[model samples]
Target: MSGTSEGPTPAADLNRAVITHSDLDAPPCAEPLPYRSVFAAAPLAMAVVDPEGLVVSANATFGALLGTPAEKLAGSVAADLMELTSDARSWHSYREVLGGRQARLRCTRRLKHPEGHSVWAQVTVVPLPGEGRGVLLSVSDITTRRELQARLRHLQMHDPVTRLPNRTLFFERLTAALDAESYERGGTGRIGLCYLGLDGFKAVNDTHGHRIGDRLLTAVADRLTRCADEAGYARANTPLVARLGGDEFALLVEHSTGTEQLADLAESVLTALQGPFDLSGRRLSVSASIGVVERHAAGTTPTALMQAADTTLYWAKADGKSRWTLFDPERNAHRITRQALASTLRPAIERDEFTLEYQPLVGMADGTLSGVEALVRWNHPQFGTLTPNRFIGLAEEDGSIVQLGRWVLRTACRQARRWQLDHPDEPPIFVSVNVAVRQVWDSDLVTDVAESLADTGLAPHLLQLELTESAVMGSAGRPLQALQALSDMGVRIAIDDFGTGYSNLAYLSRLPVNVLKLDGSFVRGFQYEERDADRPSPADEVIVEAMIQLAHRLGLTVTAECVETSAQASRLRGIGCDTGQGWLYSRPVPPDRISELLGSPGVRTDVAGTP
Candidate 1:
């Protein structure tokens, strides 16, 4: 060893190095006295290494551990014998101990025995006590402890029935693959997953026994493993298949090329499972729905990836199961927005985040604005103004439609009363509010209506209630009685989206309905003109004319919805449609704009609109 100009000989330098690291001021012996006979008979595997790393001496136990005679073990490299040279960090520490700089070095190593068996050994090194400049090395056999730990880990990380990696290990591998340095060793920087569930697996358990289900799961796992093995036979890294409890399984692909690779894997799995599985004397058939997601691993978390996979799996089931579905961010975004809106809907009403917009319903015969349909708009703070189509169904599904309907009724009535007061002479154009079936079933709709009329001082005749044609049919219990009671109060009851529902006019005539809003499908046919303007599209005209005549006989006035063109308005008016409501008049406009429209003569005839 070379020394600096400020230092003495290398021997003196090593002595100082050894002394500096010692807890007590222990001094190094000038020279090795000699080998002791006791060392050869020691029970532990031990050896002596000189500063240069050559084995100066070895006990019989150490020689036996390496399958060599004690005499021949001398002069061999101690690091090579102990297999410490394989790890750069451990080898460096060993050299430091031999140089009298480090106090001790300890690490575990797997070493091959002379019998061709490998065993885990914990190696420890320290400066020789009375031997000059050399270090003492000892190796302890920890193979039993290591094997126990491995067995415990296997039990913890694998599923018992399928003998495959469980959810815990699946997530562990997923998190590792999503790590920034996952592919630093060099490969494509993408991760993929094929999350699948057995279609109608519950039915299998219900029809059969759980033992059969477990055996079936085991069979599925074996097939999945074979698929994965076949897919990876030519590649260095193979995809990992895991059973995530129940019948759900996941195949994680590390360093995936792209979605194409995942798609291939998912398709192969689907095809492989197409064959039937035989357990004991029973042969059973099963299918899987797979959700495949593959993307650059950068900036992705385990939770995010799993969520995307879960959502895609749902799409597969929705798209008629036993197939694979790839993730579409656009569709996912729409669903996310819908969920956000649903969560905020109930609170939005309390937050005053709702506003009313009115679309004028003009009398087709005279072009007079007979009424305005009050449509509710959600002026969400985050998503901006959203129409009924975006959140109405969600609200209905979650039972929030009751509260929302009440708000719309009161707000529309109040605004209608204000318009009447603003221009007292103008025949108060009635404000029609749409009602959902859930509102009638879930709430005291009659009391809500009466309260709104009383609170707003709006006349019952001036406020019309609209229910879908489907909702109004088969009206017997509360819904039918509610309609009857509302009609008795002079509040006109109209069946909305007519001509698309049951179309049972007899059953409808039995109810107290006063109006029928023909569905837009019936009016859309008249939007384009036929070669002979004298004969409108008869397919549509015949349907509309017959419906209008039947409705007239039932004494129910008709309103044409989605009336977009002047030709459409004229044709509907010619068919005796009592009123027409659509873009032809105006899209739903703000309350102030509706008031402005009322001051004019009428829409469609007086106003040329293209919305």
Candidate 2:
């Protein structure tokens, strides 16, 4: 080695020619411009080892990596100076570089310095353009670089909180496997996915804040990871757990043994998650619902597989959480239809496809119109005009009930104002609107009602809100506060569908409620009789009498709902029911029809008839 120094040798003096074996075999026609300058000036830590594994020359960085002087590096034997530990089998692997048979030999091994400090290096041996006498070696102290790359890979592919592969990496692996299956010589290929949701996760998040919720999720991930590790497959194919988001997670299983195997894995996951999470001072219980979708003989597309998993997961939730459900094409079709409907609802409202009809509430005493309950109808383009009974329950579940409820409030308020203006002296019959639980929670009910009243100039007293007893009873915290605020503004509050809820009469007086609309179930009992006459059935008279007395005691008015016949009306009137609304009076009619009935007392009296 010429000019053995501390810093890298000047590049101008270094060899720049790419040596070819054919040229090396031809001659040494020029002065021996030894490749020593090229080795010393190289950016990578480069060296040349003779057949005896002695270092002939080393780059500046190579000497620095080994903490040895570049001059001293030449005489040292490579194997003697370095400590090597690796899984790669043979030292002869490096000879390929010398004979120009192989391009490189890369291995991870520890390098021992003269000062006794150990360093990790990624050692690469490449054939120098020389005779089979010496080989070129490059050492990269990749400890920091490799560790950094490992950390970066972890951050990119795994969820920070759960340490599970995220959707991105999972999908990438799935797509790769799917591609491999496409070209494989095997007769057919299949992939399975298990979509999972944590049951009662929201309740836990609600009871305990997000911190504990995260801990619980971490615990769940750990359990799933353990299961994945225990699975016996070349790539550890139990399931690739991924947190899609929130309480939802998914798993990808390849070369699945069929539906039975997938189901067994799902069962294992559920069993693993069945235990309680001891999160920082909080013991929270959680279970998982799994939706399994196995590839059919016709094969599965990635989108279809994921969608089937999603649909099946919903089935698991619907079938009552903490269980597994297999994907069925027919069931998914129904779910897709419902999802389509839900997505279209808001746009329908925007397109002026919704309308309200008025159902008359008749005063039981005089047989006259006391008020009209505004019922919503959706004139859906695809499904035709749908009644509240068709979609109200679904709307409430999807949280679209809030927007729908607002529409109903505004429309009913506007109609009541019009009715008051048209009739001027008919004592201003109040218009009632049903409030769903979702509406109560999602909207500032007080502001909505107050604003509706102001916008339509409808009297607060003439605008009654009918909340189902369950809706009212389940309300607490902000919901109860909103209802109380509405009551303070002079709006009447009525509990609709009363008897079906828990009979907590204690809530009646305390909840600012003014009326209770007996549920139609109890009212139907007045006329229907059970098979065994000896055994008393749920009697309407007994329930009505008790309710009426209870209402009086609580200073609330009682209304019997679904009163259809003269006999039921008579029974209700005799029992002191203040108001009644049912099909007998008239079904829900358009605004014009309501006006027609209000204008003609003959029609009202004749409609009341024998009742």
Candidate 3:
């Protein structure tokens, strides 16, 4: 017998012990019987329902499950289950099972109990073997499990913070879309991915803390999602969105009817992100850089597609950021080569493959030697003698610049010391070395300089560290402090390529710097100066004079760089420029030639091999 209530069984009590089982089991009569028990029992509310959907019997467990006695459950029509608040789907399945169509049926149904609580149960009904007249129904509460499954599904498909599909799910859907495109009515089955990142994401994290950063990321996710939907042009289905990680997000646009579809989609994404995002009460405005890669035109593999997008994204960042770039294989190839080079740089350094040459900084007054700037070169085993331009930027990107910078600093200092030993009587000349931003940030730059000075016995005044204004400004918090400490340690600092960064004057006075090497743009103007040019081309001479005076006022020495003509040199000296460097002095050359030049008296006046 069975019941569908939460009370004990009254039917079994009234029926008393059936003599068939008890007597046959050998309890009261004689020998042990074979047929001990024939019925199955369930630890949940259950009852027997006839083919016409009437309750035939109620067990103790079923009575207890429904909070009613077995007597109350018996002889009730199964349709009366509606009084217990089962949903329509459950009732329909129950009827279907009773009609001889399904052998068993299970469903999650709601129950409104007398205790005023709504409960959920996994209800299973199966045909009883003893004749088709009855059915055994079992119910188990699985409300917790159902909810857990829902939560698990949510997490598996989406990012925890942004609530967007993660990389795994995005790629899965993307692969499916690409496969579908192959069979669909489209041109070359093209799609597009807009890989985007917030421009000032780090600043947001730093200034407002990560708590706010998380909120900002969520806001960005919403903005990107909306943009993706717009780009998708939905038409039932055309686009999917996902947050790859951090400030990075991706949008997959499918069945791109034309190449213009991708371009339009990119524009829409950019437009959407241009607006301000409201995060809590903070109206945060941020711009994103997007890298767009279209399928077929780009590639078919997932890796190739993502890489192309990433390369284009970097191009967006490189071209002043807060913009979009379409992937071009030719441009991406260069980027791939640079990435490969950056990864190989440290090992190359360890292999002792880097070399240095000196470029002269000539004195404008007499066209004589001032000093040489130490420039680095990489004698790559595969690609011969690469100049600083080829690898220094790469080093900076990979944070290998610190190690490379140390090498250049030490080597250049040692060479300066060697020159001093070779020409002891000559005026002590300075050897300017370029300092990478990574070196300033990672290493104890002051300590490196101090130790290098002591190790080489080179004077602190003779070793100048050349920094671009951008490098100084780019160094945040601790790195800025490091620069100050290094300056305080008596090492002369020169602002290389000066007049390039805006707002430089604000930091100029506070910086304990010694020299400003005017950027080549202004210096190159003097290259056209003719021997008989009237009164120094008033504009160039006046501008040069103004710069020199400004440097003098700031107590900073001025060095005119790229001084390639005699007339330019004379004009620079006339304008009170203290030093100059250019092809006019010497192109960067080998160390032995530098040593020989210092030894030859007449050669200094001609200004060849000065650096």
Residue lDDT tens for model 3, 379-446: 98877888888888778887889888998999999999999988888876789999877787688888
Give a tens-digit lDDT track for model 1, residues 548-599: 9999999999999998777787778777889989887788888887777676
lDDT of each: 0.85, 0.76, 0.74
Task: Give the TM-score of each candidate.
Answer: 0.88, 0.57, 0.57
Q: How high a TM-score does candidate 1 get?
A: 0.88
lDDT of 2 by residue, 1-611 (tens): 01111221222113225444443344447554445444557777877677667787677888888887777888787755544322334355554444556555666776666688667786766545445646666777877877788899889998889988888888787777677544274533667787999988899888888888899998998888776666545553556778888888887777666888788778888988878778887777888888998875345567777877887998898999899999988877766767777888878878889999888888888877878899999888777878887678778878888888998899999999998899876667789999987887787888889899999999999999998888788567997898889889999999999989886887776788998898898777787455854433456568778889989899998888887777788778878999888877778888988877665552243464322
Q: How accurate is candidate 2 locally (lDDT)?
A: 0.76
Estimate the TM-score for candidate 2.
Answer: 0.57
Residue 316 CA displacement from its true place in model 2, Å:
4.8
